[model samples]
Target: MRFTLKQLEYFVAAGETGSIARASERIHVSQPSISTAIAQLEKELNVQLFLRHHAQGLSLTPSGRTLFQEAKRLLEQAGGLYAAASQMHEEVHGNLNLGCLTTLAPMILPELTLSFTSAFPKASVSPLIDHQERLLASLRRAEVDIAVTYDLRLSEDVTFQPLVELPVHALVGENHPLARESRTTLKELAALPLVFLDLPHSRDYFLSLFDMDGLTPNIAYRLTQPDVIRTMVANGFGYTLVNTAPRSNVALDGRTLTRVAIDGSHRPMTLGLATLTALRQTKLLEAFVSHAKSIISQGYIPGMMAP
Candidate 1:
């Protein structure tokens, strides 16, 4: 016999509440409508479901008990269909592979993970840290769903969404002469000891600032890690340029370091989210991207100076 979902829902409601009037109230239908549907269901199955008395509402017979159990299961399955459809509307579950650069990853990933996990609990998030070249390649190959990287030398295959404008700050030891300066120009900074990130992409980007200002950087050291640069700067070694400003607690030794802002409009290094143009966005990726964008807009991004 062909039984509709409405009939099964009516049966479960009646079985649970033990009254047609109460079942109709729960299902938001008229009592007569629910009673007629249940009656039609039992008639179609060629069985007597309810033992209705003059005063009592309704009681399940032996066959009614079996059908009522099956009706509950069917209702649950129907509810699952609705739930699955709703989940599709909001990207609730899927694998999201994301990557971040070394410098920004340490600063941003912790907060991002904590907040995003709470928001999209069903999503499985796998985060990786790598240089820009490898990260961009991963995005192109659809290995990583998204990447957070410096907005310099971006590839065409990757689409970028600006997350934050990270101010480039000069790291100098406490004893350095320019450390006392409230803010110094790139030209003045060029005269001091300079260190590059030593990575090919970043090396060129860092050197170009000096080259654009028509001054040669006084090359003193080449380092890859930001912490190494911070260590050298704190020990009164050569100063280095970095986009993300480190916290005061994250200093080297007891000597406090200084952040000297450039005089002119320096390259505003943007930390942006990148995703492959080709890959179809899953539910998790969409939710993550939405949450990330909201967090960034809400001023959650680190190194954002108060207005």
Candidate 2:
């Protein structure tokens, strides 16, 4: 083989990211190194792998797409060989590409990832935080090996292992009229302004709670960032629905907030691990899965309030 695995790895990164600069950021290699590797690989392979677009970035050529698929397969096989060796030694090693829901990441990832790595010092985790749709897409594309997310609109190609149930809560400013209440109904909240967490599947799930009762919330603000939504709620902008309640009742701006359980039974989101159904679970992945199952349970979770 004229080209090395390092060159193939760089080529694959460029193909996936569609830009040498972005690829460099992804793989922690310098842009020049990635560029040189790609140039060397193309020279050895005797093919034009990418069509450069001025200021727009790179795109795979027809042959490049085919080779990209094979390159990804080869990388997976190489990872499998490493996994096999680790299994022989009965040790967990290598990097676990973990995807997490953006809303849950801050509360869950730090504790969860740190503990796992501490337990298995040889294994490290790289986290990608995003919304539901993108997380699922990442699983399909093998961009992430496992995703700690909600079981929301999961496709047939993905498998979800339920970890715990997180029921919906009405988040409000401490001084809000309903804040004193232990629990509230959707009907009562429908009349008031709502600070909506406007993400793909998350938006639908929150709205569905009202839809189930044939009601709609008077949406006052639609925000993407969870902290921003919490701060808005703390400032009495409006109440928002959240599944995972942080350990603290105070928002980032130092304003107090309240978490009131939604009255009656509603569809609680199931927090779980999601992965591609077709992908074989490596020994490292198995170890992480076991650790996750042990830590995340009904009565206890790492960063969030007890369920």
Q: Rate the local accuracy (lDDT) of all candidates.
A: 0.80, 0.94
TM-score of each: 0.73, 0.72
lDDT of 1 at 162: 88
Clash number for each model:
1, 0
Candidate 1, 103-140: lDDT as tens digits: 77877777887788887777677888888888887887
Give the per-residue lDDT digits (tens) of candidate 2, residues 1-307.
Answer: 8888898899999999999999999999999999999999999999999999999899999999999999989999999999998776877899999999999999899999999999999999999999999999999999999999998999889999999999998999998999889989999999999999999999999999999999989999999999999999999998999999889989999999999988888999999999999999998999999999999999888888988
Residue pairs of candidate 2 with colliding backbone atoms: none
Q: Evaluated with TM-score, which candidate comes out highest?
A: 1
lDDT of 1: 0.80
Q: In model 1, how many backbone clashes occur?
A: 1
List where candidate 1 sits over 4 angstroms from the true fold. Answer: 1-91, 252-254, 303-307
Question: lDDT (0-100) at residue 230 of candidate 2?
Answer: 94
